[model samples]
Structures are given as structure tokens and as C-alpha cells.
Target: MASSSSNNTHGKNLRNAVVALLAPLPSIFFYLSFLRHYSAAAEAGSLSPLWTWCYHHPLLLANTLFFLNVNVLFWLIGVLQSSHWMIDLYWTMIPLLLIHYFSTHPLAQCNSWRSRLVILLTWVWSIRLTHSYFRREKWQWGAREDWRFSDMHQQYGQKWWWISFFAVYLAQQVFLMGICLPLYVVHSKDKQLNIWDLLASLVCLTGVTIAYFADTQLHNFVTRNERLKKLGQDLVPNLDEGLWQYSRHPNYFGEQLWWWGLVIFAWNLGCGWCFVGALVNSLCLAYVTILVEERMLKQQYRAEAYKNYRKRTSVWIPWFKTSLTGKEKET
Candidate 1:
């Protein structure tokens, strides 16, 4: 039995190593192809007008290439691991990469105070969120997948491989690019910093901090609850203290605030179309994310604790509270 167990462990480790080695190939290949194609087109000067136009707009070209590379890589990884959540790690990282690329690009007008501040805040937010996700996921190559993805695998069976490419990976890629649109606008034009820019910066930072602390509190609660459970103790189904007390989804609220800050920054630049990204992000968070998450929580807990918490706490707004009887109130 011991020898068999050891053999199984070794097999799993070998599979993980292999997957890790091959995971980055798709992105590397796509990036090299993009550079070569771009260089050849520039030298020939016979490329189509559309390709020529894309070359002038570095952000557009970069966004398209980056998205294509990452999306393909994600699908490849998912196919290898049979886990759709593999794409989740890059959700925060992609925006930061795009912002950094454009900010440092020669074509970018990123020397203004507003641009610098926005870049700094974006870095902070991205780093915090990435760190949180890394720790929470306890990610390792060839490890057990997220429960949600596991459920999807069971539901879709064999067809899940291709279905997830579109439903999960590509859909998330679209959302990510949309949310990062403000960075494109910010780098495209040279604009002086204004008071609104400062306000937006503050709001963005505040949202990041709020989300960080809320996640921390929830993590601690879960840790304690698990420890107690191991000791044969029963705890409540949901955490409703600290930041969770004010809002059932405080982290989601903070996320909305952070995205809305981008909207404000773009609006300050006098571009109305930039609002589309934040608007779409808001709808996704409010409708898709929260609804699905709450439903999952209810199904998992089954007890009345989560239901009661939902009734009393604000769904997305922290300040606005709800009553047990389904009445709205200002907290």
C-alpha cells in the first residue's frame, strides 16, 4: 500500500512538472509571431491600411496581441489540467501588464501627474489582489481544481473542454479588456492633472484598501471556523462581523468602487465612450457575480444563517442596509 501510494504521488508530481513546462509555450509563440509579423509589415510598407492604422495605435495592437496570447494560453492550460479556473490568476495581472506597457511605451503621453498617479494606484491594486488570490487559491500545478470548475466539469462532461474556452476563458478576457479601457484612453492623450484626478486616485486607493481588509477578515474567520470544526465544534454558517457586517459582499462593493474610479478618471479626460467598460463591469458584478455567488452560498450552507445575513446586510453597497423583513434602511 505504501509503495502504491508513493507511486501515485510521483505520477502526480511528474504530470504537474510537465504541465508547468508546456504552459507558457503558447503565449511565447504568439508574442514572437506578433513581433515578426509587425516587423515584416513595417519593412514592406505594403501592409493593409487597417494593419498600418493598428501599428500607429500601439495600445490597440498590444491589447489585441496580449489578449490573444493570454486567451490561448488559458485555454491550453485548462485543456491540460481540465480546470477552467486556471484563467483566474491572470484576471488582475493582465490589466497591470497592459497599463505598464502603455505607460512606458514611446507613443504614450504618460508624463502627466494624473497618469502617474493612476498607474501607481493600479499597481497597488493589482499587487494586492494578485497576492490575495494566490494565497486564497493555494495554487500549485496539477492540484485539485476550484469547486465551481469541478461542478462544471461534472455537468458538461466531455464537451466542457471547448465550452469552457468560450464561456469562461474568452468571456473573462473580454471583461478584462473592457475594464482596462481607461488605461488606453489615459495613455492615448496628453492631459493635465485636475482635482477630479486626485479624487479618483483617492477613491481607487480607498477601494483597494477596503477590499483587502474585508478579504483578510473573511480569511481569518474561515481559518478559525475550520480549526474549530476539527475540534468537533460547530460554528455559524456565514461570517457577519467586521466588514462583513455592513455588507454581505463587501469585497464586491470595493471592486465596484475601484472600477468606477476608472470611469471618473476617463470622464475627466472628456471621453464619454470610456464609460462603457465600467458600466459593463458593474452589470457583470451586480448581476452575474453576486447572483451566482449568493446562490452557491445558499446551496452550500442550507441553514438559515446565510439567508438571514443576506436579508440584513446590503448586497453591494456597504452603507445602505437591509432589514430582516426585507425593508431597506440607511445604516
Candidate 2:
């Protein structure tokens, strides 16, 4: 029995490793092929005007590639898996890819400390997020889809097969590409590193650190509750300690800060338009937060506790709790 269990675990680990190594290849291949084809077409003067325009505009090219790779390819993969779980995994990876893509493009003009700093910070953010994702997933790939996607599946019924293309995958393309626009600006412009860059770096790093601790705390809380349930003990009603005490969703708050921090970099580079991405992301997160809180309230075991917790806690930003009577509560 022990030997069989050990072999099963080993098999699962090997399969996961293989999938990890291969999962990014398709996107990488598409990116390289895109650049190669663009070069050949440009050199031969065989490209149409629209294609030529895209070649000159790295942001446009990135979005086009994103459309094909994520909107089309990832959507198809999600259909095959009968789950949109893969997109959740890739969310932690896409920014990292975008940062590198912009920095390495033939038209890239960046070769400065700002570029290096942005890339390094992106790496840090990606690694931290990816690690949190895997930890939440118990190091398993695609074990279950996010609950919201599952809800949408049922809500949309048969229409989900098509609606998901736009609602899930395409919407993600818009948000992800938008939030990553700063990466393009960082690489496209050559600007001297300034106080703003220092400030942006600090904000980005702080966001990553806050998100790391918040997620760790939440995960530990959940794991402890699960263990208590198995031991036939009464489960904790709600998590209202640590960062959760100050805000209902510190993880989300941190994530918003990270993206907006990138926007600061672009804004300093004179592309304030990049704020659109961070703004859209914030709106999306606001919607998700509503859904999450609604779900929490529906849980009979902790509904009242969560309602009181909500009364006391700020929705996103960390702050001193409020009294149940809606006045500021001293912590």
C-alpha cells in the first residue's frame, strides 16, 4: 500500500513538472514566429498597410498576439478542459511575458536603469503571485476552476460555450493587456531614472509584500479551519485578524496597488493614458469583491459574523475598523 501511494505521488509530480515545462512553449513559439514573419514581410515589402502599421506599433503587435494566443488559443484550451482554470494560472505569468516581450522587441529603445528596475520588479511581482497561486492550489495544476467561473457556467447555461469566449477569455485579454501597457511604455521610451521611478519601485515592492503576507494569512486560516473540521471541532466563524482586520480584501488592495504603481512609471514617462488599464482592473476587482462578499454572506455558518465583520472593516484599503453602529472603531 505504501509503495503504491509513493509511486502515485511520484507520477503526479512528474506529470506536473512536464506540464509546467511545456505550457509556455506555445505562446513563446507564437511570439517568435510573429516577429520572424513580420521581419520577412517587411523586408520583402509584402505586408499590407495594416500589418505594416502593427509592425511599427509594438503595443498593437502585442495586442494582436494576445488576441491569437490568449483570446483564441486559451479559450479553446478552456473549452477542452471544461474549466477556465488555466487562465487563472496564466494571470500570474502574462505580465512577466509582456515585460520581457516589450524589452526585447526589435523596436525597443530601452537600455536604462528604469527599464532594468521595471523588469526586476515585474519578476518579483510575478514570482510572488505565481507562488501564492500554486500554494493556494496545493501545488496541483487545474484541480478545480474558480468558483466564479463555475457560477457563470451555470448562469449562462448552454450559452456559456460561446459567451465564455467574450465574457471570460476576451475580457481577460482586455484587462491583462491594458494593465501591462506600462511595460510597453517602459521599453518604448528612454527616460532618465528619477524620484518617480524610486517611488514607483517602492510602491510596487510594498504591494507585493503586503499581498504576500495577506495571502499567507488567509491560506493558513483556511487550512486551520479545514483541520479543525476534520477533527470534529467547531470551525472558526470568520477571519478578522491580521490584515483582514483592517480590510476585507487586502490581497486585492495590494494587487491594485501593484498595477497602479506600474501606471505611475508610465505616467512619469508621459503616457498617462496607461492609467486606463489600472483603472479598468480596479473596476473589475470591485465587481469581484462584490461577488465574493455576497458569497460569504450566503454561508449560513458565518453569515452573521461576516456581516458584522463587513460593518467594521473597510472594503479594500487598510484602515481602522468601524463600530457596528457605523462609527469609527478604535482598534
Candidate 3:
């Protein structure tokens, strides 16, 4: 009976994974169809005024497509799954979608090298994040939702059903699209690759490397502690090694660096406004970091150790640890 139950769960997860894989197809089809029709109309000089406007303004079309797919289709999937876990998976994928959308659109007028470089970098970053996500999920698709979402579910009770549309899906649309505005700018602008491009690429790659290692370290720590728990031994209280030793949230910092690094590419292309998305994302991360720390302090076994770790660690940017005073040492 135990074996049977495990098999059932595996079957459900496999089915969910297949559905999640195909969920974005419709939106992608629509966008490509729109582009094809727009191109035909442009050549014949018979384009509708609104279609002409859309051709000139690709970001507007991108966001509208994103809304229909995420806000509508993804929400329905979440309602069916009774869990918003799918969106967490989509978070790593949407940027890859956006980059392709911008690069393939008729209006794409970017330097060939820069466009290809950004797309390649995005693929690398996406792969790393998706792998981290699956590892965090223990390779079980849709088995668990993020802890923060679970907290909100409890906080709002029945009201969460409606509130989740705004709080979860819509909020993600804003942040995801905002941070990805650089993709559009990168494709729209035709500046030649320069020294700044090299610098931006370096920064972006460094961020991905840092985030990859930090997540791996944190995952190993949690896994080891879980093993100890199973053995009825005392679990390690905190992760104060590797990247966590220098910063309370090195992963968040690394993520921000990656986004901001892309913004540098946009800035070099004369689209400084692209920074808005990365900036907003950082601000949201700040709130999330505070919430995470508060939750950590609530843990009986982890609170004392985490409190001391927080005192000596930088909140975001990594640096050498601060020395503890005599009073702090005694405590």
C-alpha cells in the first residue's frame, strides 16, 4: 500500500510536469501569428492604425500576451492544482520566452552580436535557476508551493482565492516584465558592442556563478540537517558557511546583480529607463529578506544562531564579517 501511494504521487507529478511544459504554447502561437499578420499588412501598406501602433510598440504587445497567459491561463492552472507551484517554475522560464519574443519580432533592430550574446546569457541564467528550483523541489513537480505563499494562504483564509489573483499572479507579471524590459531595449536599440558590453557580460556571468554556488551550499546544508533529523540527531541550526557567511542573502544579491548587469547593457544602448525593473525587483527583495529573517528568528533551534549570524553579516553585498564585541561574545 505504501509503494502504491508513492507511485500515485509520482504519476500525478509527471502529468503536471507535462501540462506545465505545454502551458505557454498558446500565448506563443498568438504572438507569432500577430507578427506574421502585421508584417503582411505593413508590406501592403494596409495595416490598421492600432496594428501599426503595436508594431512600433512591441513592449505593449509583449505585456498583453503575458497578461493573458499568466493572469488568465496560469491562474486557472493554479486553481485546478490548488497550488501556485507552477508559477514558481514559470518564473525561471518567462524571461527566456521574453528574450526570444523580442529578438524574433519584426522590429528587432539590435546589433547581431549583442542580441545573440544576451540571448545566450539568458539561457545560461535560466538553466541555472530552473535546476536550482527543481533541486529545491526535490525533483517533485507541483508537490509543494513556496513557503511564503502558504503563509499568505493561511493569513487570508477563504478570501485567498480572489486575493491570490492580484497578490500572486499579477504581482509576478509586474516584477517579471519589469526586470525583463532590458531584453526589449537590447533588441530595439542598434548600438554596436563595446567595452561596456564586455563589462555587462562579465557582471552577469559572475552573478550567475555566485548564485549557483550559494544555492548549492544552502541546499547541501538543508539536506544534511534533514538527514540528521531522520537519524534522531541534533540538526545544524544555521548555514554560516560558504556564501552565507559573508551575506545573509547572497543568492538574492547575486540575482540582483544579474538583473542590474543586464540593465547596464540597456544603459549602454541609450535606454537607461530599463533600470526601473531591476530597481523595483531589488526593493521587493528587500521586503522579502526582512520577512525571511523574521521567520528564521522564530525558529527555536535556529533563532539564536541566526541572530548572531545576522549581526556580523552584510545584508546583501558580500564583505568580510564584522568582529563581535566582548558583550556579543559573552552572549
The C-alpha TM-scores of every prediction are 0.82, 0.89, 0.95
Q: What is the C-alpha RMSD of each candidate to the true structure, in Å?
A: 4.5, 3.6, 1.6
lDDT of 2 by residue, 18-107 (tens): 655576677688668767877888689797666567568878777877788778877887787688777888899889998988887778
Better of 1 and 2 by TM-score: 2
Pick the lDDT winner. 3
Question: Which regions of candidate 1 deviate over 4 angstroms?
Answer: 1-54, 139-146, 289-302, 320-331
lDDT of 1 by residue, 1-331 (tens): 9999878877875776576556546644644554566678767867666555655777667656665666676677778766655456667677777786667554577547767788888999999897777667554444556566677778989888888777777777678888888887788767777788888888898899889999889888878877988998876577788888988788888888898888788888877587788888888777766555566465655446665666677777786555544242222
Off by over 4 Å in 3: 38-54
Residues forming the 10-long window of minimal summed lDDT in candidate 3: 48-57
**lDDT winner between candidates 2 and 3:** 3
Residue lDDT tens for model 3, 234-301:
98999989998999899998999999999999999888999999999999999999999999999999
- The C-alpha lDDT values of all candidates are 0.73, 0.86, 0.91
TM-score of the candidate numbered 3?
A: 0.95
Backbone clash count for every predicted candidate, in the order shown: 0, 0, 0
